[model samples]
Target: MKKLIHTLLAGSLLTTCLATTSAVNAMTVSPQNWWAGMQNSSLQIMLHETEIAKQQWYLESYPGVELKSITKTDNANYAFINLEISPNAKPGKLLFKNRAGDQFEYPLLTRDKQSAERQGFDSGDTIYLINPDRFANGDSSNDTVQGMAEAASPSERGGRHGGDIQGIINALPYLDELGVTQLWLTPPLENNMASYSYHGYAITDFYNIDPRMGSNELYHELSAKAKQHGIGLVMDLVLNHFGSEHEWMKDKPTTDWINFNGDFADGKHATSHARQTIQDPHASEFDKRQFSDGWFVSTMPDLNQRQPLLATYLIQNAIWWIEYADLSGIRVDTYSYSDKAFLADWTKAIMVEYPNFNIVGEEWTSNPAIASYWQAGKINNDGYTSSLPSVMDFSLQESLIQALNEDESWNTGWVKVYESLANDFLYPNPDNLLVFADNHDMSRVYTELKQDLAKTKMAMTMLLTTRGIAQMYYGTEVLLDNTGSNDHGDIRIDFPGGFAGQKTNAFTGQGLNSDQVDMQQTITTLLNFRKNSPAIAKGKLTHFSPKQGVYSYARISEQQTVLVFLNKNTTAKTWSLDYMREVLGNHKSATALFNKQKVKLTKPLTLPAMSALVLVIE
Candidate 1:
């Protein structure tokens, strides 16, 4: 392995010989490595080094790969090499020699056997959201890396904690037993910021994993191990912006690499929050430009996706992860904040390669019409065609919270949820939406329901059985709350007993109180039952309007019908069977899975106060 980097002064090709032999030092090649036998033979290899453009290089042909073209960017340090890898190509190295006698090699490994056939997470999967920095601590040694800016400070809300990839890998069995089929971890990629980098949003390196979290090899290990436990890993990434410490910041590939507040020289950008401008009909060009081009914060520099090379780089980065880590899905942060055209193209490119893969965009809008515009087959009036398979159901999430908290009235309590679902027509494929009661960014579901266990259970039941992909934050099952404040650090609390010598361990159930244990068991039972329920997985849902303080819905499939009822009354309410006769049809009796009791459809069933009932009918 050559570690020494040799470079010549500012000069054209053959100005000087820096090294007599090939060297693999001082160069960043992304994707750092690639696989042979890909569906698309074309590969774009991006390279950045000290005055690398001035160097001369030629491809030493190998069995599977062929050199196509080397396009130098505006920046002298950057170069884009295009290659054609034929299907007949096998795993090997494609050697190259520069004019100055320095040699470099690109490894072409065999693709995973299931690369193209890999299935992404979908509506049938239950996603367990983990904020790794706050989730658990498996390896204490990686708590602080030497070169990293932020070190481990588990006690602080926004400070880095020791929770790494191993932490997540250690809790696989716990998650599996909880019945979560998919794992959605917030970005584990490197942030390398000065502070407050625990959230992993301000990424400094796209090709490498956060050393504090783990290594690139370990990320692969986690994904592989997760598959064994029947869990699919969904990688969360930010394409819109990157941390100021990113390598490209100091030496951008082009003049327009990033939007510097429409002024690149001095760098003092103005507008930061402009997410709504993309969909606003009255939005001006200036506002739209600012929204897509403005930085998220002074620490995060907004990338210019309009730059063709930059756009391609972002697209390839996502594809590289799916191929390298065997990821089942992608959760793009601030989806609509990026260039709209670039988003459409970016989603289309990935879907084309992995036709079965799922990518859920985070369009955090409460309006159904705006949220629907990003989903596939939306047929927007703007004539935009988005290939995204799913979107985070922000509209439904908000409605569910409001529905459970307000008093019963027109568009108030249960009607809020009913009305939210009624807007399903606006969405192209409502069933594919990603639904959840709360996430790392918001108040915990327990806190949102004001610590009311019954209301919490009702919200959980509604989300779990609804017609969309269901997701739950890590500490939700144990009643994690951020009651007094909305600080994210409070919302994304560290798991009890995640560290050594801790007293309360949610995993082993060693020190949890009765209420915590019960909530955990409740979630486990509901998720386990939902895992095999065809009626809840892919069934057609029909919900009746909330009436007399009672809300009911039925998930109907060819073989079974799953019925759910929620009573908002403070007092136990007896519901008549006559009202639901149309949905009941010929089923004489239904088994209540919650208590394992059978209820006769011919007779009225009394529901406990503020209760949720789940019944399976054949």
Candidate 2:
């Protein structure tokens, strides 16, 4: 075996020299290993070492595998090895040698049985979004590690709180009991930033998990154990930009690797956050470039995906994580900030590899037209084709908050939500969209609704029974709120009982107040029932317009029917059922999901003020 040494040099690609004759000691390769028999026969391995481009290497007699070519960039330190692995190839080690007799072996592993056929989270599953660093502190030892810039500061809201992967693994039973079917943790990849690294969005290393969180093996363990509890794992992916502290920033693979030639120009190249430019036919080229190529912040340098090599690296990095972590789905961050052409190709490659899988992108726009433009089957006016199966429904989320906060009127209150849902015609597959009231980036649902438990419950009820897949931010059931502050750290506050010195322990139910307990029970009941309800999961959604301070909708299927009434009234009122005859369809009496009392559909239903009423017909 030859020794290939890797270093943090600009475009340095490792090439081994014979151990017997050369003194080279080690090397680094992106996607260090691969699986045989993948749908995509081609693979590109990025080798980074000193003067690696000058080495002439050849494959050592591998069956069903061929070294198609070795391409080098302007930087001699970087080399890209492209290989074609046929379907007949089996899992084993493939050897390579240069003319100087230096040799190295790459392992091609076997895929897991039924790996490609894995089912992604959909309307049937309730996804729980967790900020891993704030969720729990199962492992305090790793909170402060050697060589890491930041140390744990549990008292400071924005500081690291020592939560690790083991904490999530420990909370599996708790999550299972809450009836959550899927977990979408914020990215646990190595941020390696000096500050505000707890949110895990600024990725410094794509291939490895952060040691502060856990190892790559431990993350795989979380996936496996989560499966045991009947939950799927959805990884959070970032492709638009990376932490400025990343090694790539110091030693770029190519001159054009970073957007604007690795210069932020004192925020001159910052994004306008004008996502609408992507779908706007009249959008100027300058506006489009500013939105796409601009850096998010000085600390997050935008990636130049137009560079073909960097594009391939990102696409392969996503696939590698999916295979390595046994992921069931992915939630892309800042989806529209990257180059549009690259976004199409990247999504296409992932879907082609796993046709049954799903990927949801975060467009973060309240405009349904712009959001729907990215779904897989939409026929855009500009002839843009997208392979994205799911997108976050920011329109509904924004309207729901407004509806609950405002007074009832023709153009206000519940009408806002009704009009929002009326725009569903804009989406190709509305049911495949991700519906959530709040996530990590914004304020918590409870806080946004002014810590009103009734309003919060109404929001959760609406989401869980809606047409699209539902997602809940962690601590929502217990009414965690970030009142008077919109800080990311405050929004992602520590989960009670997850850490020490807290009066409340949501896990053990030890110090919870009545409101917390009631909220928790409400979510549990709705989630468990939703888990089995064909009506809520795959039914047709038919909602009536706002009438007399009430917004009502019905999810009807052959097996069951669910009726939801959200009343924002200050006083209990009798809601007439005459207008919903089309959906009610001969149903007489129904059972209330919360209290299990039989409701007579034949008479006017009495709706509790400022609360969500859910009834089921069987």
Candidate 3:
């Protein structure tokens, strides 16, 4: 009887072992081949398990690889292992050994050296900014989350329209023909909010990309594909705050992890505080603290960048993405809201790690002095050194608005842009300024200008031909507009025909109004022209306000010289040659870029009203 009972138990144990082996074999790993987006000699490997605690798993690289550290995360199901690859470690499969002697193999690909350096894109490139959820709905299956609140349909202005990273990737050829060289999608990081999370500003997880948009792996793939088409990717980073539902809020890491935790503080207004503190002779420490540390919104918890650990975490998160995505640059959102010291340190560290990388900060100050102060080489009266290389030219935006809305008189209106350009001396490197007519935060450029096509064209003409770097918000080329509503939802409208069921498609130039098509063609022509024109890329800028409502500038290099003239008058105005004779000395003949007409200038040239002219002088 004892022998028979022992045989039965042994048979049951063998059956259980075989079942486990079969289950392991049935499991599948996606994205069979893995390529590190950005990497160096040192690598951090994160492993996740559905059943067993990751701490029970032992991770070891190839025979010649060196282990730096093996760390268990707060969640026992994940493990973080740091390893140093051998200088000649042949790229192969990474083996993870579990306590049960079960092994999982993941293939690894070595870094592409040429591609890594290509990550840093140039200013000559046009950036298309899309609010993903409002751009297109390539995949509708992932529209609603299981337990999350359901968003309204695409027709609803504020609804989550199911636009994903795949949609943008699908429409790459459209962007490419539009002469876009870089794509800046608003923060794709996870935002687990119940409503209005479509904007992606309130991030819940820094490490994971929003599943609604796509997986983190898909994002890396998008970057790789973008690079293949001569396009770069610029990540939008938010360091000031995190979503209130962020995991850290549930269980505080430290008492000082966030400012005014649980309890909300009425955030101080930005303009006065940011501008006054920098300009004030006796700015209070308390006031400055409130300006930078206050929460942006009740739903967004402000991060205490002053905290050492929190600061380090934020910095490392940014570096991890830069190295992980092989990104071209970063456009920091709400840049002024973060601690000034921390911002300086963060930028400095990033610049040190990637010497040639560039970062543009969103310091939305309309004053040139205030904007210039944040740039790296600004000579401030107060000894403030910023590691920031570029700042959004809010002054230029103000100038554009004034030029469009105001009268054409010399002392009053449309010449504000010319006058603003004269103030470029205030900035140490004016060429580095990111000049834009509009962005995601504000009303669409078309809406702001009251849907005036001529003014829109003028804005694009200046943006493309100007001295500084230029950025065009998505949909601007197609003249996308949100007529009455000034809210963000309306501003970030759905791109026409982006969805599968849509009757009109912007990609094929179908279902577009005549004005929209004209704007698209104009922008495309100018951008492609600028791409091959060395005269516009690296040229010396010279300007003269020959008269009211008439402004002209020349960008000259050793190989080529190009001149631009803006005439805002109702009638054709003749610009006297005497006023610009010194600058145009020995240049008698010029060819217009748009019309391809050549003219000999002896006395004065007639510039039409509400028109811009670009001349190539040989």
Tell me the TM-score of each prediction against the true structure.
0.95, 0.96, 0.83
Better of 1 and 2 by lDDT: 2
Decide which is better by lDDT, 1 or 3: 1
In order, how many clashes per candidate?
2, 14, 0
Residue lDDT tens for model 2, 415-527: 98899899999999999999999999999999999989999999999999989999999999999999999989999999999987889999999989999999999999999
Candidate 2 global CA lDDT score: 0.90
lDDT at 205, model 2: 84
Q: What is the lDDT of residue 467 in candidate 1?
A: 96
Which tens-of-lDDT digit does each residue in 131-194 have in candidate 1? 9998888889989989988888877888887888999999999999999999999999889999
Q: Say which candidate scores most in lDDT.
A: 2
Best by TM-score: 2
TM-score of 1: 0.95
- Per-residue error for 219 in candidate 3, Å, reads 1.5
**Prediction RMSDs, each to the true structure:** 4.0, 2.8, 7.1
Q: Candidate 2: where are CA atoms >4 Å away?
A: 1-25
